[model samples]
Target: MTIDSFTKLYERAVDLQRLMSPFITGHLVVEFLLRKLIQIYDVSLTQHADDLKHARLISLNHNISTITDAQKDALVGINKIRNKFAHRITHEPTLADLKTLFIKCKDAFSDFTDGIEQGLSEIDGAASVDQLEEWEIHELFIQIAYDLHHVYHNRGGDIEEF
Candidate 1:
């Protein structure tokens, strides 16, 4: 095949690399927050808790009675996307696969203002989450992780009566 034919493939590889870096690392940050939350919730827990993987930690995060079903879906969707990248080495996940999770995030976190009609990002481009660029989606993912991190940082954060 000609180099011209491979241009799209090269672009996709670049996109994946750029996106996956944040996706993987951000998932780790969120997982850390979840584990910390669980530990703080139950002080009797040991480092055995650290052995639990991302999904398990998410399951545990659910023990917080205030976490909504939609909120759990965002975490679950993040893990699902992480799994596709981590486990499906040969598979090329598409924007279609990601859009669903973006939708979940939008649903999961309703606190965003500027009105729902304006769509996901505050930055220019992509009027809707479905239209989010590769970079934009990762930005949203990082935001999710950062928001979780802040909750952990805020001490007896707004998540509960604690």
Candidate 2:
């Protein structure tokens, strides 16, 4: 894929993260990551949630080493949440729901939170920078998605119609 297309995908994920429900945003971000992985590894994949699940297994089998264990766990959590929203008529993930998921996958998010905090401190904000609150799960997820995108691009992944 062209850099433009990659960037557009990342931006769309970020936009969804900012404005959509947590489940929807998480699903979109995970989907974006899966698609990027397919391109990165040149794997034949259909765009399905099951394919996304299998991508992780295939990556491990191929030794592609795409995501950390914590990231894999986080993706699983995201998928569960997305599934709940999709299958249940009254299911809507709240901020608290997302926060719990983040806590459950805290290890995966440590580097991202640290980087965001450092970046925030470097900027001149109205108030002194402190820890990111629980309500910032959306921002946290956005940064994580951005970092994942950079990882793929930095590792020389590109899209070319074949």
Candidate 3:
């Protein structure tokens, strides 16, 4: 890549790092919210229970059963938020909206992470999925999943399962 492209990529990475604090948090939050829904509605996603693979699949699947309508909408919003913040794709997201989105994203991330952690905790030998020490583990996988999903969907193909 040219120096300009490298610079742009670096700048975009910085912006995403900043936005990720909350975007990731939003993801975690949505997880907890979904669990709460499970508790309240007695909606058991046997397919989703205790499986990181399934959890991730649910995150990317618009038709995933464990996710509620609100959660799905939030996912769509996250797609937009990531594009705007990480790609500098728009000039219209206001500072206020950005701040709000960041905070909400953080909240969602916390909730989702908590739920995932709790679920994983039940598995013998599973490690903690916290942001402080292991952010990259979760962040990298999440980004890859999202990027691949975007590419696959754009090409009119379903996400491949392994």
Q: Which regions of candidate 1 fall more than 4 Å away from where they truly are?
A: 1-18, 110-134, 153-162
Better of 1 and 2 by TM-score: 1
Q: Tens digit of lDDT per residue, candidate 3, span 1-162?
A: 122576775775565424355555645644444443333333365345335432453453435444444545445555565556445432333444433443443333334334334323332232322222234325423543344344334444445531
lDDT of 2 by residue, 16-68 (tens): 32323644665677566656665666545434324545445434423556677
lDDT string for model 1 (45-153, tens) is: 5375688787777776776632557778888888888888786533434555555666777676543332222324332343433344456555665556555655555
User: Which pairs of residues collide in candidate 1?
Assistant: none
| Candidate 3 TM-score over all chains jointly | 0.31
Worst 10 residues of 2 by lDDT: 122-131
Q: Cα miss at 162, model 2 (Å)?
A: 14
TM-scores for every candidate against the unseen true structure: 0.66, 0.55, 0.31
Clashing residue pairs in all predictions, respectively, total 0, 2, 14
> Which candidate, 1 or 2, would have the higher lDDT against the true structure?
1
Please report how far candidate 2 places residue 106 from its true position, in Å. 3.4
Ranking by lDDT: 1, 2, 3
Residue 156 local lDDT, model 1 = 62
Q: lDDT of each structure?
A: 0.60, 0.53, 0.42
Q: Which ten residues in a row have the lowest lDDT in candidate 1?
A: 114-123
lDDT of 3: 0.42
